[model samples]
Target: MHAHIALDGPAGTLRVTGAGLPAVELVRAPGTPADAHTPIGTRRAALLTLTVDGAPAVIRPARGRLLRRSYRVDVRVGGHRYRLVPCSYGESRLSRDGRRIGTLESSGDGRVSDAWDAGPTPLDLAVGTALAAAFGTGAAPWWETVGDIVGELVAP
Candidate 1:
């Protein structure tokens, strides 16, 4: 299945629409800082919440390498757990039980698109779209850049 996500910058909301799934609206949790300074492994993490089929789903930062630049988030919906692992550029992989189920691509323009395998249910699609909209096209966190510079200076 395919889905399109549109983000509202001022309202801090994301709306996802697709063929098979009901429209999902994700709102950024209040007081949640932006991911630039709240990368994975940080004390403060980004959070987005949505409802799917009358059940609530939450997407929040998951544990990851302290020095890495990409963002990682754990999604819980419909009694299932999924992980979003973002790579360089604007690509991310969605996995469940260590198996890839979908891919999300962000255009870095308040728009994200996703393609999912047939095995994913509508709830999964909603969660995936929320993840893409929340963390669009990862960028190096400020601390990561500082760490890189420190490492380079210490290298022999």
Candidate 2:
């Protein structure tokens, strides 16, 4: 179970590792139509558990090394050819009128890479030319293109 999350810091501690690292384990998609643990496509990558005002977010680590800006693809796993650490698929938020509208992240291994959902249409310039044409990676945002660094804060 172990899904808490409450780190505000005073005693100082915070390591809610990427995408809600609650013991790390959740992989579906034998057919995956959802319900296998929620969160699917449309920026899929689940694990969740981050409250804050209601408490929950208290893990640790990341007092130093936690760079994590790396990007890669090509995944198979189990059957071999594994490289699947696939993540960044973070989509959830939109307020508008209250002001916020926008969010959408989608690195692969979640399988849907028609060249990473094919590009261009203001999704931060097709997620910055689809993360440099699907993972040669690096370099975007010169004057805004590469869809604003893959749409900056991760598209929407």
Candidate 3:
């Protein structure tokens, strides 16, 4: 099952509420073809591999999601209502343009949840967070004080 949640912070605000699991896999977006022996489709993927090589990780989970070391949250964000969703303690990796998004993780499941106290954030922020989680700075040294993403996800 899918859900709706939001992440609102001083940096920005965003919402991730959608139903149904994305066809993409937890390891990487599905059908992305990441055999270094072969060619992958995106340069961002290569950069992510280079930038996030061997970074430390600290991940927790929202709701009942797994909250353990070496584990991150797997969140799919979107929806017209309640615009933000955070996985409690995973990291985000945005795309080059800062639009497309996806996430890399050590471990965690659908533990993402909305911050009921603060309420939800704007839809744009939700998208941005998802973007960050997917392929933006969260994937780079700028933010990888946290996780390891073996593959790449794209911008929306």
TM-score pick, better of 1 and 2: 1
lDDT of each: 0.63, 0.25, 0.28
lDDT of 3 by residue, 66-94 (tens): 22221222233332211112333444332
Task: Order candidates by TM-score, high to low.
Answer: 1, 3, 2
Weakest ten-residue segment in model 3 by summed lDDT: 50-59
Clashing pairs in 1: none
Off by over 4 Å in 1: 30-47, 63-70, 115-120, 138-156
lDDT of 2 by residue, 1-156 (tens): 112222222222222222322222222223434322112211122322222223333211111112222222222212222121213333222121232323324332221222223322232222222222222222222343444567776865
Best by TM-score: 1
Of the candidates numbered 2 and 3, which has the greater TM-score value?
Answer: 3
TM match of model 2 to true structure: 0.17
Task: List TM-scores for all candidates, in order.
Answer: 0.66, 0.17, 0.22
Q: Residue by residue across 28-134, what tens digits does model 1's lDDT show?
A: 66654444433111322344566665567766664445433336777666667788876544577888766789888765455667767656777677777766665
